[model samples]
Target: MAVEVGTTEPTEDVIDVKEVTRAERLRSMVARHRAKARKAAEQQRVNVARRVNEWFTSTDVTDAELAAEIERKRRREQHQGERELRDRVRMLREQLRAADENTAPALSAQLTAAQAQLQIRQDEDADRMKVSGRDLVRARWMKRATRIGAVGAGSLAYVNGVAAEPLLALLSLGAAPVAWLYLGREFATDEAPVVPAAVGPDGTPIANAAVPGTPFVPDTLAAMGRVSVVKPESGRVQGEKDLVTALIKAGIITAAQRDETHLAGVIRPSGPGWTATVDLPRGVKSSAAVSRVEDLASALRIKKSRIEISADTTDDGHEGRFVLWVANEDNPYGSEKHPSRLIDADRWDFWQQGIPLGGDARSTRHEMHLLWSSLLIGGLMGYGKSYMARLVAAAAALDPTVRIIVITGKTGPDWAPLRHIAHQWIAGATPDIIRRVLGVMEQTIGEMQDRGTELDRLYEEDPESVPEGKITPELAAKGMGPVLLVVDELQELLDGAALVQVAIEDEPEGGGRAKARSGRDLMVEGFARYVRVTRFVGGMGVFITQRPDADSVPTKLREVCAKRASYRVKGDRSAKMVLGDDAVANGAAPHLLGEASKGVVVLDQGDEQGHVTLKADVIDLPQFREICLRGRQLRIDAGTLTGDALEYGKEDAAAAAAALLLTDCLAGLNAAGIDRARTERLMELLAFHHPGRYGEMTRAQLQAQLRDAGAGTTKKIGAVDGMANANGYTREQIAAAVKTGK
Candidate 1:
């Protein structure tokens, strides 16, 4: 009844109770609003996340660039690098095609490059990132398969679109600056500048954020490219073996060169950026033949000098280092060379095809006389002038008829290596000492002249068919050993006018009055005489300096020099001075050194033409890692060399003291089953390092000689004398005879 009547329609007895309480209604309203607010907040957050993601991924629009271009100006360089890589690949293929040419042995240089490329591709495929695109147009396609697989097909379709379909893929490449600003993982503002490393105005670092007073970057360990995946390819390399092969082939090289060439390591980009590394030899001395050393170095930003080279030598031993600078540049960047360097490496006396000595009109004729011509070689401070010079002395020492004498003012780095070869030296800029030494050399020359005159008188007294035709080098070469003089850092000593004048005057003086004084003076004089007329005397003179100019070497000395070479010369004037007419100087060549910048020069030894524009040779501290490691153990001072190895004309040196110290050469030879002990004893006697003296004995007497070189007393010497007497060695018979009765 109550339900039927609208006015009395209260279901539960129509109690007059308010169903909504103000507080409860407010709470309910608040709850509903809170639910809506939560959804709105979640949506807001989702939108924010989406926006952040979008910020990372750019749309396919030409103007959607956001990141700052760090090295926007270097775009040209980037393109050049890519182009060079491509061209290199092409050239290597050509080399492989002509692998059988030349007599050096049939080696397909391209095969090695191709194999290396394939190997790198395999590595990239396994570890490289996967980016979505219809086709990764700029990205290199590295795969082991000739036919695209499911993964590759999907990737290609996503990036480049269907190969058969007419679709254009708009690539979103971030500017270099933007890449660093956003994509680069390095968060700290501490980053190296785009400029090179050098002392700033306040002597602070301008680029690198490296900590002070440390050799390497703090808290940083360079990643190494290890465990590469090598893909097997067919007879021809047209696919995956492209990039690496291109790297090897980019230089003007031959298939035979590659065949004989060894791969120390293949460098490749790594990590979240363009990181790369090189795997080196076990000893780091294992050498590799490269096309353009500068290009390789520049591309890798690695040191080009200090590249310890080793090649197959004769059993007796053969070694040599020559500067072939026909294609060198003075201002490399100004030239047409791509990448401006070799393989990201620093210039450290890295050899290359240099600039043409007489511009484009250059002759390939080389007329250098190994026995008679004085050669001039130079480079900047960081270049490899000193190292290369040392190598030259080493080469000279290999000849039995050559005697090396060294004089230097380079604070020991240069002189120490040649301790065995150098008869005289000063490691620092000591003009007075150097002058006195030169005086003694002049006196020695005078004495040699006197001896020659006396011999002529004797010959006249007893007529002979051979009349002395100037008693020239040709004659000397037939009888006597040639002399070699190496001066390291002549610039430091010949820095001032007074020093130069004094040095010039000192050449005429005999040694000082006293024994040590005379000895020092004589040694110095001997060194100078070697430089003055060594070539004419069937000898050689090697002059090394960071600064080579008219000032460092006076005209009196330069007149005879027929060869000019350098790793890199900083100044155009210096380049001209060292290279002579080859490049052109202010006096002889005005516009030849037109740009007048780093790594530019011309080389002329009379008509022989050579030129090179390049940065100084930088010791490849990476490949020379072993040498650097040995630097820890290098002794600042070194004494005279003594031993069987000290024989005439041997110029090679074992520079790393650590390696020498680590192993006993004698013991090693013994282990290799060589009879070094007997030879060592003989060495002691011949070098005068042992106690007993063989001053009067001749070479013929050595057959029967029994003098104990290690004997420290007269009694012991006498005992040895008795033994020698029994063996038919007589002091009177041998000592009284001059020239061993020859």
Candidate 2:
């Protein structure tokens, strides 16, 4: 190369050789880098393989974790077992412990403390059971002496010739030794008699009998006078406890029965005697409590009638609440000086507080507010049934806004005073009177319709006028009457209706009879369905009946009349007839009422599910007349009374009488299909229906009368047997004429 370089000088081939060397160096460097990367990858693969192998074959590690878990479970179970064993050992140690000297000092101390606590508890129990030693001793000795005296009396009676005395003497002599053996026995028992409060005849509270010469003092007192006012609080407390204990001891209440009736608290003096409120146990009703009243009174050594019990449901509507009034005397309504006054002085403002029913045993006044009420008054004859009905009627009469209607089926003067205030009065049970009653009912229907329309209009105009959804005093003051319909002796009406029905079915009478019967049935159904619910609509119905049996008064009417008053019924059967099916079982024994219970009645306690004793107010005829006269004057001043009642004219009387007669005749003759009648025939038919007005009319007079009354109309009549006939008037035409007062 040195020889050629010398020859060729500088050749371009050197540059190419240098470039080739650089390229070769670059390739070698790349190969070295790839080899280093391969070594790194191989080391990583080896590390991964070692880790995986270690994971699969590490049995010692798995065994270590499993051993740790097993140790934890063992410790948990062992702890549980130790706890249970400890409890068992503790119980055993307690069982082995004793309260003797050998016992531990702590246990002995505990035993001593327990004994002392027991003694303290016993002492406290004795204190709670403590009673008046003086009263208890006196009563106990008196009872013992009474027993001894009875025995001695019986021995003397046996010496005489009294019947059954020898047997009583022998029995007493036989029991002497046994009784003497128990002579020193403690006379004080848990049960003691309740000493009742003293009350005078005028219902004034009397002082206690602890002093001499008091009226309530025991018969052993030779000289008794008025005692100082002894506070009855302590005595009442003892009485409450003793009452329950005596009841239990006398077997009126068993140990299990204790839960059935509970004495609420201490007795409280109310009215004549002490009143104790009691809570009837589960499944026991006020009626059940009432049934046990006699036994309860006997257990307390009081008269049966003295125990006045009133059973009612609690205010919360859950259990039974019984009020037991243990009176010193038998009379509860003996305060003649305190006649029941109206609950409120303002009759119009307090219409809902309607009329006073009477005063209760507790002197709480009750009312028979008939604003939205239908009442049924029933009882045996002469047992104040008529009196109660009259009382309510009189109450209605006292209100000028009330329009009174009396359907007195019986011909009596009991309701005679009602006529002065009555807008319509039917006083007998004759056929004509029955027809008049039917007319009255029809008129009542018309009145109801008119009132309903007026009421709607009034309400639409101003709802304030109809307060409480009823006819308020303001609405009634505007010449809108609150109608009251009194049906005394309702059975007669029912019987008359039934007879009419039978006659229609049997065809014994005629088509008129059929029409009359149909009308009656319609009116009765309408009355029961519509009129019964009209109380809130300003119409009230009072149905009085001697017999409230199903036949006399329909079940619909009975149910409609929600307020029932029964007095002196024959038995449970009759009582249930007036009240309800459960009346007898609910302790409504009206038959047991004595003759002295003239004004007393068993009144239904609506919605509370029982009956209560109510003494009705007795208003004489003179008082009723005064009330009627006052009401009449008020109505006149208010311009509510008008027509014949206010200013009767001869024409007005004749028109009214003719209208009544026309109604009676139309009811019978309309069914005959003879609407058009000759004047003579019409007069004859009217005479047949009501003989009092049309019976003496001649053909000319009747024609003139019909013409004057605007009942005569000209209508062509068909020729009969080739004879000319004049036009005749129809019953409808006559009725329309009567309404117009032509």
Candidate 3:
């Protein structure tokens, strides 16, 4: 201990160390192994149960099953081919018997070839049957041998201790026998070859296979069974499922009501999309689905605009039926419009063939019958309201027998191209222009009356020529062409504020002022009368308005219009106003059209189907101008050019304005039933008739004008009714003055 400070001394103390036997260690290892084995066995049991369930329930085909199915299909196709060959041979023999000498040789040759082909098919079918039988026998033998071999291998493995565990040995010994018990029945008895039955196009079983000369008849009950068969899901079937699911989700139909409704037929291609017919439940109407179009689109994950639902009003049973069309593109109407058919037309036969306006959703061309009908077009601004109207005007212009009178409240270039061919082109929304519009309506009313008189005269002189009491093409060609009045921006002329005030100097009772009447009121009355009387006399009116409210188009006028076209509008109210409440209820959805759907309109031609939604033909300014030029040339060739066309840029504005005064004076005299009137009274009537031009005219000026027109000087005249004496002219004087002026 006294050696060095860094050195340590060792001291021994007794310590006990625990030691285990080899047997205990082996027991611990064995316990861990047993736990893992138990866990693996439980997992194996679960996997086996899952596999068994899947094999029983899964629709997936195994390799052997798939091969067998393919072979069966091949046999069926071969049998069908043989049957067809036999039918062809029999048909050729019949045709040969009926053939003439010139065609007999060809028929005989075809018959011989068909018979040979049929014989060859029969021989091939026999060979295939033999081969199929041999293959089946071989397959059965192979399965039996595999079962025997598996049993031998399992027994040997168990006896040689290759399977260590008792459970493993038992599984090995039992697997082959289990497979035998499960599969042996398939090979125990030989089954007859399955003969493919004759099936219809819809996969329904038909009657027994036809003899060579007999017809193949379908079984009605079996045919009905086709709808009940479990078929592999197809695109159409999936689409139908999706539609039904959407309907259910949309609350349009309940799950319990699913079987009560059904698709009328298989979904089929239509235009650029797919179409299907839905047969609704008894209490459901097609409008129910139409009203829920947006809900359906949302559930189906499609654009709302591309889904079109219309009532199938083709028959009495159509109340519960609807036609659904789903377009592939978001915008089925397309961004660009189709060119108008009238643009290239040399001359439209408006009498025999109607105007080709545009194509429907199915791309089917639709024609508008302008004869014996009036058209009312309405919509929001910039939605092709004017374009649609001008299209009609252009179509009428192409017909040389149609006299076009275009009056527009808009002074834009939308109607400029039509001016070249118009009989009376009046444009502007000023008070003067509105008065002129009223004046035009009055003149048209007079023309309608004159035409009616002429038709009556024709009916009396040559009743056969006017058999239907309507204008004929022959009569139209003989200087009695139809008159078409196209009024654009009609609301401007129909506004309540457009009034004309006139002063009465010589009242029958005393000098009193006459109440002012709006030009709108007069125009509406005149138009109503024209529409009511001119339909049979070859007079058509096309009234277009951007404002489709009640005030824009009066009820009386709208009721008389037989044809209606509505472009995109703001709401259902406007749509109903234009197309009628019944039309909208029946499934006309013009309000659904978006800004991209320019030139698209819903036309209600008073047909049983409610309305036709179509894209109007596009006639741009250049094309329209060219068409009008062509129309002008046509009118010139037919010797039918008159009115503004005859005096375009040649008539003096002041002279034309002055000339209307004499006509107004004479109209006033006729209206009052007076032979003559005082200068003050005549001026008042003139002011009322042409408010813009003559509202401020003086009595001296009117007398001077009458004096210049070869009428005698005014003098004191007794009141024709109960009025005081006044210096008025006679009706004869005014009539003579008008005649002299003309």
Q: Per-residue lDDT tens digits of candidate 3, residues 481-505? A: 8999888888876763255532223
Q: Where's the lowest-lDDT run of ten residues in candidate 3?
A: 209-218
Residue 604, model 3: lDDT of 94
Stretches of candidate 3 above 4 Å error?
1-241, 496-508, 649-742
lDDT string, candidate 2, 589-615, tens digits: 565565666777888856555677767
Better of 1 and 3 by lDDT: 3
Sorted by TM-score (best first), the order is 3, 2, 1
In candidate 2 the C-alpha lDDT for residue 29 amounts to 96
Give TM per candidate: 0.33, 0.51, 0.57
lDDT of each: 0.37, 0.60, 0.71
- Best model per TM-score: 3
Q: Write the per-residue lDDT of candidate 1 for residues 1-742, one digit (tens) a residue.
A: 3555445454666533465476678899999999998986666566555544434342211110111121222344444545665566556655655665582233454445544554344334322222223222222122213123655676766665634444343232334345434442322244222222334347764331211111111111111011111111111111112322433553423334433332222211111111112222233211232224444434323333311112322243222211111112223234332221222211111112211121121111111234555566676665445544433443343333344456566563444544444444445555566665465457546644654565466467854523542333333334344555666666665552134333223333566532223333333345445555434334566666666667665555555666666555544466556655424421222123333333332334444223323322222323233232122122111222323224422433322322221123233333444332232343334435323434454543443332211111111222232254222222232222322222
Question: Any runs in candidate 1 off by more than 4 Å, and if so which?
Answer: 1-368, 447-479, 496-534, 548-550, 566-572, 580-601, 608-742
